[model samples]
Target: MPLRPSRDVFITCAVTGAGDTTGRSDKVPVTPEEIAAAAIEAAKAGAAIAHIHVRDPETGKPSRDLGLYREVVRLVAASGVDVVLNLTAGAGGDLVLGSPEAPLPPDPAGTDMAGAEERLAHVAELRPEICTLDCGTMNFGEGDYVMTNTPAMLKAMAARIRELGVRPEIEIFDTGHLVLAKWLKDQGLIEDPVMVQLCMGIPWGAPDDVATLSALVQNLPDDWIFSAFSIGRNQLPYAALALAAGGNIRVGLEDNIWLAKGVLATNGDLVRRAVQIAEGVGSRVLSPAEVRAKLKLERRW
Candidate 1:
């Protein structure tokens, strides 16, 4: 495929990820109400889509409670925000080992492995327009915590996502993850115009440099709608890079907490910065309806 930059773009705001970010930043949404408010704020600012994850209201820990998800969905719908909803199915794959010397049994405190159907329970009920599918398993960071998504598990989830008429945002963390994505497509699991997310600057994964981003963007199959974003300080800059790389943009508290050198950012702030970056470069910011058409998302709203 010839290199073509995206002049028409849509921004997805990852309101509050399941990461341990609540204590670091007060702006990071914890409760369902706060999370929905942040998504609504992003929508009001300029985001076309809100990528969601629910957390425990009391402890502010990441949770897979169906009731919590329902509350977030209800709040977002009630807020009258016309943003496309993208729920996460990456919660139950966390595998924290007990020790390197004896790695037989996983740590019960952190490990949250579950069956494919259980992992996607929220997605099945909420029926969001989009949900993430972490394409490959990798050591999440400097620890025994492995983000495990085996081949069999992935196929089962992909098939179910297709059956539900909800688009799966294939999350490519490393180069090999992209290869796995192609394999999934070849297996006739994902549909045409596949929506992909090139996650960059992650530990033990792909770097956030222009060369790495460009290489991945270039390798993407023709007609695949991709969005790219890096974590931490690179998150804001990745917006411009993604627009330049013929892709869409994703930003919010989930990826980064800083709005500037020392200032903390809300999801709305990150989204506004992304909007400025997109519009400043002459890219037309797409709306929710336009995103639905471009990615062929089944509208739940």
Candidate 2:
């Protein structure tokens, strides 16, 4: 298939993910107001979409509290920022095992498993334009924790999201995940013009090398709309590579922190830098409206 010429590309800033990184950086937003403000800042900095994940207000830890999500969404909606809201439905699935000898039992400190409905409560109520659906189960990292996404769970979530008229941003961490995503499509769980995010550079998943990225890209269905990004130092560079590979780009504090070798990054800084990179490659950055049209997303209240 012939590659599409560079046109306006959309940039999604994953503002704050459900990770335990709040202690690592004070810039990470904990309160709903802060998350909304950070998202607004990112929108002003040229982010077409803001992928959000709420944190616990008191402990600064990841939480699946629906009220917190509601507050964040309300604040963002009231902020008057022209950015697409992409809430995460990928939390509450971490399953950390005790040890190699006792893998049947889960580790208390790491396990945070919940039912699919419970996991997606925020997305269901908020009705964001886009929500992530992790494609399959995988070892999250060297730690005992495993990112659990059973076939049944994925199907249930996808069906519910479709019913709510929310687009599911299929999160593909490896080639196998893409296979599962395709299967979901074949099973009529996912709708036409499916959106996917090629997550790279995480441990126990596909490495952040050209060969791996190219292979993953090649394996994707011709009609699938996809974007790609790597974590840490390679985040900006991956923006260029993803565009060159005929895909979109994603970047933000959720994936990386350093603006440079030693400089800590704000979400806006990362977004502004990504915009510069995309424009440098002769591709105009898409606005929130453009992204909505391209992705066939429905804006919610």
Candidate 3:
């Protein structure tokens, strides 16, 4: 891909991530209602898609509770927001090793492993417009915790997600994950207009650098749709890079909590800033309906 800058770009706001950022930012939405409100706020601020991950109301920890997801979806629908809903199917694959030497039984407190069906329980019932499919397993971050997404596990999840008539946004954490995504497409697990999220700047994942992002963008299939993002301070800068690289952008508290140096940001603030960045560079911000048509997504109201 030879610097094919996208004149028209869409924004995906990751309302709340499954990270331990609640303690760091007061704007991180924990409850289902709060998460839904955040999504709505982002939508109103010009985000075409709302990437969501629910958290436990009381503990402020990431959760896979179906009821919580349902409430969030219900609230978003009732609000009549036009943003496309993208629920996370990346949970339920956590594994924390007991110790460096004693790594037999994983730590029970953090391990939440489950089969394909169980991991996507909420998607089956709620049937959002889009859901994520993590393409590979990785040592997610510091410590013994690993985000496990084996080949067999990914295949199973992809097949099920396809059967549900939901679009799976293949998450590319590393270069090899792109290979798995291609393999999934070859296996007929992923269909047309294959969507991917180029996750960058995590501890163990792909680096957030110009060369790295360019390499990943070049490797993407010609017709595939993609959105790129980098976490933390590099996030806002990556939004512009993504647009210039012929890709869409992702932002929100999920990736970064700061709007500026020492300034905390809400979901709405982040989306507004992304819109400014997009428009300032002569790229038009796409709406939810435009994204739906571009991706050929089915609106499940």
Candidate 4:
């Protein structure tokens, strides 16, 4: 893709990620009500979209509970906010190996594998405006845990999401992931104007660096709309970087928990700050309506 300057930017606030960070930060929304409230707060504070991942409220751990997802969607809808919903279909693919010495049983406590249909049950039922499709398998995080999303699984999930009239945000963790995403698009599994998110600074995926970002950006289809984000401290800087690279931005507690050193941040605060960065860089922050029009998103609610 030829790099062009951008004057308009849309921010997607990833409300709560499926990570083990609930105990690390008091600001991370845990319950359905809390998550919905945070997402609404972000939208009100200038987030074009809210990227959500439901958790087991009591356990504060990642969950695939269909009921939890339903409630979150209900609460967000009841708020009457205009935030575009981007629910995650990336859960239930965790695989923690037993051990290098043993390597069996798959550690039931750490492994949470599910069928493709089961992983997307909530998305199918709720029919959010946008849902994510993790485009490839990778060794996510540290240790023996692998994030498993096979070709067949992604194909099925992408087809189902299209049938539900929801846009699938293809998540690219590395260059290979982007290639796979393009292949999916070529196979007609994904619609035109493919929306992608470049997940940077992941432990085992792409690193948070300029050369890597440039490589990924250059490989992307010119006509596709893309966003770039990094985890932790890199998240804030990526707001400017993504725009400069002719893409959108994503930020929230899912990628970072701090506004600064020793200071916690909220979803609204992150959105507000991201808006500042984009505007400061001479880019107009786009509203939800603008984002929908640009992405050709179908809002059912």
Candidate 5:
């Protein structure tokens, strides 16, 4: 069968990821209310899905607290927006090693690894339409830090997510990660019509270039549905590129912050601009219901 023409492009706004970005910008939502409001705004501005992550309310640090996630979900559910909720199952895997001298001890200030069940506590309870599963591990920038997601852990999490009746949006940072994702699908750990997110331009992972993007796209399974996005200035351009290459798109503060140089951006603004770009390129934006139908996503609980 010939590839389907990219007409109904869906945009997912990553409202606020579990990162230290809260401290850097006042625009980053910290509390559950703020996060939920931001997600609503993004949905109103044309995002079909809202990718969410909660934080410590007091310190504004990334957190895996299930209560925080629950509150955010409740608020969004009450807001009456029709956006699909995609909770982050990508936390609790940070392995910040100690000084080279004391690597065995694992610095308390840095390390935050947890068991599989503990990591996915929120996903099990909240049961969003979708939850991300980082397919593999990689050195995630400066500071000798590693985003640890071993194959064993991935299989375990994938099984749990499937049991919860939540679709796993497999996050692939590199070609090798995609390989592992394919392996998991082959082993029946993941389901058919697999959804993937091509995370590009992170430190020490896939480069943000056409060659790399094309290679990743070419390697995907025939029936899989996927989306792609790049960080910073590459965000808008990559939207067009991804759609033209037969995929969906993602945008928001989790990946990029500025609407323009020296200008801060809100999640809604970022999403709106992406919508404009998609429309300009002869593609129609998909609503939440449309996206749910397109990706076979379950409705919110």
Candidate 6:
């Protein structure tokens, strides 16, 4: 497919990811109040959506606690921000196997696997406008850790999200994952105007390169609404790349923490930078209302 540049683009600010990034940067929001504030700040800075992942308040580790998610959602909604909320349903899928020497039993402390329904507990309760659905399982990170999302799990999760009238942002980490997303659509598990996120440049997932991104885009269904993002240093560059490729953009501390070398960034700062890139390229930055209307999202508060 040829590159199709969009004149109007919507930016999604991923507030705080579930990575072990809190120790590396103090700007990562650890508490519900902090996460909510960061999301609201991003909205004010022109992010159409805020993608959130809650962390343990004291230890700053990834957490899937319902109460924590509830508190964060409540605070953000109460703040009266116009940004669409996108909570992470990609948690609770960590699978850290034992060392190669002893690979029979998985490491209990490292493993965080759960049923599909358990993973979407927060989504079911809070009913955010958007939630993510990782399309495939792969060898994630170094060592034996795998991001497990089996076919059955995804089907069940997709059905539940559709029932709840929440849009599932199908996160495709590689070409095969994109293929699986199309299959799911054929099965009628996903709704019309399907939303997808081409997650590039993760350690074991797709690489951050032009050829790879172009191939991914070529495989996308014509009717789907898509966005693309890259992690770390590639985050800023991909903002314009996605827009130029006829897709939306995503940025924030979740993907990259550095605004420049040795400088950490806040979620708001990342959103502001993305705004400059989109507007610099003659594309208008879209608001939450515009995104919701474009995507046909239901804002269930």
Best by lDDT: 3
Task: Write one digit per residue (lDDT tens) for candidate 6, span 157-270.
Answer: 889999988999999998889988988899999998899999999988999899999998888878888999999998999999999889999998888999988989999899
Estimate TM-scores for all models: 0.98, 0.96, 0.99, 0.98, 0.97, 0.98
Candidate 3, superposed: residue stretches over 4 Å from native = none
lDDT of 3 by residue, 63-161 (tens): 999999999999999998888999999999999999999996999999999999999999999999999999999897779999999999999999999
Query: Which segments of model 2 are wrong by more than 4 Å?
Result: 1-5
Q: For candidate 6, what's the RMSD?
A: 0.9
* TM-score for candidate 1, residues paired by index: 0.98
Query: What's the CA RMSD for each of the models?
Result: 1.2, 1.5, 0.8, 1.2, 1.9, 0.9
Write down the lDDT that model 2 would get.
Answer: 0.88
| Model 6: residues with Cα > 4 Å off, grouped in runs | none
Misplaced by over 4 Å in model 1 are: 1-3
* Candidate 5 residue pairs that clash: none
For candidate 2, the 10 contiguous residues with the lowest summed lDDT are: 1-10
Give per-residue lDDT, candidate 4, residue 130. 92
**lDDT tens readout by residue for model 1, 253-289:** 9999999989999998999999999999899999999
Pairs of residues at least 3 apart in sequence or in different chains that clash in candidate 1: none
lDDT of 4 by residue, 1-301 (tens): 3456579889999999988888899899999999999999999999999999988889989888889988998998888999999999999888899989987979888898888788889988888989999999999766889999888888888888888888999999978999889888988989977999999999899998999999999888779999999999989998888988999999999999999999999999999999999889789999999999999987777
Q: What is the lDDT of residue 118 in candidate 4?
A: 89
| Residue 199 C-alpha lDDT in model 1 | 95
Error of 4 at 126 (Å): 0.7
What TM-score does candidate 2 get on C-alpha atoms? 0.96
Worst 10 residues of 1 by lDDT: 1-10
Query: lDDT (0-100) at residue 25 of candidate 2?
Result: 79
lDDT of 5 by residue, 87-165 (tens): 9988889888886787777767867899899989999888899999999999987876889999999989999998988
Error of 3 at 160 (Å): 0.3
